[model samples]
Target: MSENRLREDLCFWAKSLFDRGLTGGASGNISVRTEDGGLLVTPTGVSMGRLDPARLSRFDAGGRLISGDPPTKEMPLHAAFYETRQSAGAVVHLHSTHSVALSILPDTDPDNAIPPLTAYAVMRVGKVALLPFYVPGDAAMAEAIRGLAGRRASVLLANHGPVVAAKDLEAAVFAMEELEETAKLALILRGTGARPLEAGQIAQVVRKFEVDWD
Candidate 1:
């Protein structure tokens, strides 16, 4: 997409996430790789619901801010994906309620954040790594994402939020929604003895959907 269209789409998806209560206040950020290989990103401190496309931050491939406002404090986190995952075209970080709640559950899997509860999660998000918590905007948070690097397409920042990288803006948003929905399912099924998809079933779906799961 053109830089202008990319900005408009990022703002549109940001508002959609906001409208759905996936993020509130100024707590989330989104970025996409422009055709020229620069980044078109949501501005820092602006609520996703009210983001302005023209005001989106711009960063060159070398990480220099070429125009617009400075990018979010979490720029390194986004940059890490672009550097590590060759296929990543967009990145989204969301402070959705249910995912944050799921992250705090005592028995939440530390290694594999979300269970293989549904086929969509497997197909959309692949395996989600559960990263140890860090202060928001900490450079260490980006390091945590770097720790997994190319091995995972999504991660749950323990006690913080979820971040997802995908081949495009639509895929990124879909993956984020799947992450939240999987968390919601986890909450609803907790202590209910509900059966999650078995390993064989998960594998079958993974194969059937041609998912790039790990």
Candidate 2:
């Protein structure tokens, strides 16, 4: 996509997420890789609901800020994914309620936070790693993500929220939404012995969808 269109789509999806309460009050950040190997990122201290396309941060492949406003402090977080995952075209991080709540639960699996409650989650998000909590905007959070070795498309930051990487901005947003919704489902089914997809069923979905189920 053209740089102009990428900027517009970034704002469009950011606003949609904010409007639906997926993120609020400057609690989310998004970045997409450009054709020239640069990145278009949301500006720091800006609410997702109010992002201006022309004002988005632009960074070259070497990580220097080239133009527009300063990028979010969570640049390290976005950087980790792009650096580690060759397939990543976009990265999204959000402080959504349900995913954050799920991250806080004592029994939430660190290796796979979101269960196979829905096939879409399984296909889009694959395994959702749960990382230990770190202070907001800390570089340690990015290090934790780096530890995943690019194996996971989605991760739940303990006490924070979800971060997702995908092939494009739209796919990242859609995968993030699926992850949050599955987290909501997991929370709702907590302690009810809710039957998740059987191992065989999960395998079928993984195989049929060619999911990155590592």
Candidate 3:
């Protein structure tokens, strides 16, 4: 896609997330990798629901801001994916309610944030790491992501939100929705002794499904 079109698509995706109540106000950020290795990102302090395509921040492959206004304050969060995940083409962060709520539960796994209760979650997100909480926009948040490196594609920031990396903006958004859905399912099943998909079953789906949103 041309740089211009990529910007438009990202804005549309961002707005869709906001419209669907995935993220409210200006509480989320998204970025897409351009064909030339640069990035088109939503600007800091802008509402995801009303991002202007022409005003999206542009960053060269080397991480230099090349055009438009400055990028989101969570640049380090986005940069961690591009730097660690070889196939990541986009990164999305959202303050979706269920995912954040799940992250705070005392029983939530410190290593695996979401249970493999559904194949779609496993396919779209692989493993959602439960990262320790840090103040939003704090540099430590980025360092926490960096700690995960290549092992996971999505992470739930404890007491905060979920961040997902995908092959493109659309895939990133889709995966994030799945993350929230899985979280909601988990919440609804709590204390019911819900028979989650067995580990062997999850492995089978992982091997059989060609979910290449890497």
Task: List candidate 3 stretches off by more than 4 Å.
Answer: 210-214
| Tens digits of lDDT, candidate 1, 1-214 | 6777788889889999999999999999999998888899888889999988888998887778888977898888898888889999999999999889888887888777788898898899888888888887788987877788588888888898999999999999999999999999999888899898898998899889887766
Highest lDDT: give the candidate number. 2
lDDT of 2 by residue, 1-214 (tens): 8999999999999999999999989889999999999999999999999999999999997889999999999999999999889899999999999999999999989888999887888999999999998998899988988888999988998998899999999999999999989999988888898999888999999999999886
Cα error, candidate 1, residue 129 (Å): 0.6
lDDT of 3 at 191: 91
lDDT of 2 at 187: 86
Off by over 4 Å in 1: none
In model 2, the Cα lDDT at residue 80 comes to: 95
Looking at candidate 2, what is the lDDT of residue 41? 98
State the C-alpha lDDT per candidate. 0.88, 0.93, 0.89
lDDT by residue for model 3 (1-214), tens: 8887898889889999999999998899998999888888889999999998989999998889999988899998999888888899999999999999999999998777788888888898888889888887889888877887677889999998999999888889899999999999999999999988887878788889865322
